[model samples]
Target: MEPTPRPLSPHLGIYRWQVQMVTSILHRLTGIALVFGSLMVLAGLFALAMGETSYTAFQHFSASPLGLILLVGWTWSLVFHACNGLRHLLQAAGVGFATVVFIRNSWLVIFVSLVLTILIWAWVIFGGAL
Candidate 1:
């Protein structure tokens, strides 16, 4: 006798994407990205200790197009991660647990993070502190 075909189990495709889901995924990803950013930090510090030649090379790389892109991405990740983390902390303290409040807070995290990131980069671009 032929075996009967079984129905496939639903996976990610079954669920509609939502703000909470997006923020959750981004939180984890940005956390990982920050770890790499830290390595870049360490490299900068090491270059400083290696004296002017190495430090100047590091500065040039940081000013390059690719480096600027990475820097901007890293800055966004840092802000997003911090915002999401603060939301998580609030939830742990029994705040924003209601469905409406939860969804609203998720959007808030996204909005605030993006706004803050833009402000930060703008300051840097405009030559911070006149």
Candidate 2:
């Protein structure tokens, strides 16, 4: 018997970029960022537990420009991860399965996460209802 030829797979170039793609990729990358950010938090806690001097040293380092950038990135990562995770939970429940609804939710996840991150930072800097 003659062998049948298999159909060729579609090339990556065939697909145009979409917001859904960005949201999916960002979801994964932000998950990784959250892991590192958690480690930083743990280290901060460890420093605090060690003694006042150690905690003060950690404070100084955290106040540095590089630390501030990392802190902001970590904050954004957390917000984005949580928003995307909730979106995924809704999707698992068969919500937002329509094409238009999925795309809109993707964009909403990004926007809402950023707004939340900004709000959190503002509260942190300005003091949150304290």
Candidate 3:
């Protein structure tokens, strides 16, 4: 008898993008990004404490176009991670346990995260702290 050919498993293209899915994956990726971003923040603080030259170098690097782009990305990651973390905390507290409630809250988390990121960047661009 001939052996049967087995089918390949479904893949990324087979799956549609969903709010909950993106939020779940981004939560992890943002957590990792924040770890690295936090190091940059610490380096900036330490440089400022050291002297004017070191502080100026750090500030100059941060103000560059590439640096600004990275800063934007890292900022969004931090905001999203924070929002999703709160969602997880609420889940732990037994909020949004139902399927519909869970999905609604997942979207809510994503939307609020984006809004928070925008507000923060706006504040920074307008010369204020978030």
Query: Best candidate per TM-score, number?
Result: 1
Off by over 4 Å in 3: 1-17, 128-130
* Residue-level error in angstroms, candidate 1, position 109: 0.8
Residues 34-118 of candidate 3 have per-residue lDDT tens digits of 8989999999999999999999999999999988988999989988898889888988999877889878988888888789889
TM-score of each: 0.88, 0.85, 0.81
Model 2 residue 11 lDDT score: 67
Selected candidate, larger TM-score, 2 vs 3: 2
Minimum summed lDDT over a 10-residue window in model 1 is located at 6-15
Count of backbone clashes, every candidate in sequence: 0, 0, 0
Off by over 4 Å in 1: 1-10
Clashing residue pairs in candidate 1, if any? none
Error of 2 at 103 (Å): 0.7
Model 2, TM vs. native: 0.85
RMSD of 1: 4.6
Model 2 bad stretches (over 4 Å): 1-14, 128-130
lDDT against the true structure, per candidate, is 0.94, 0.91, 0.87
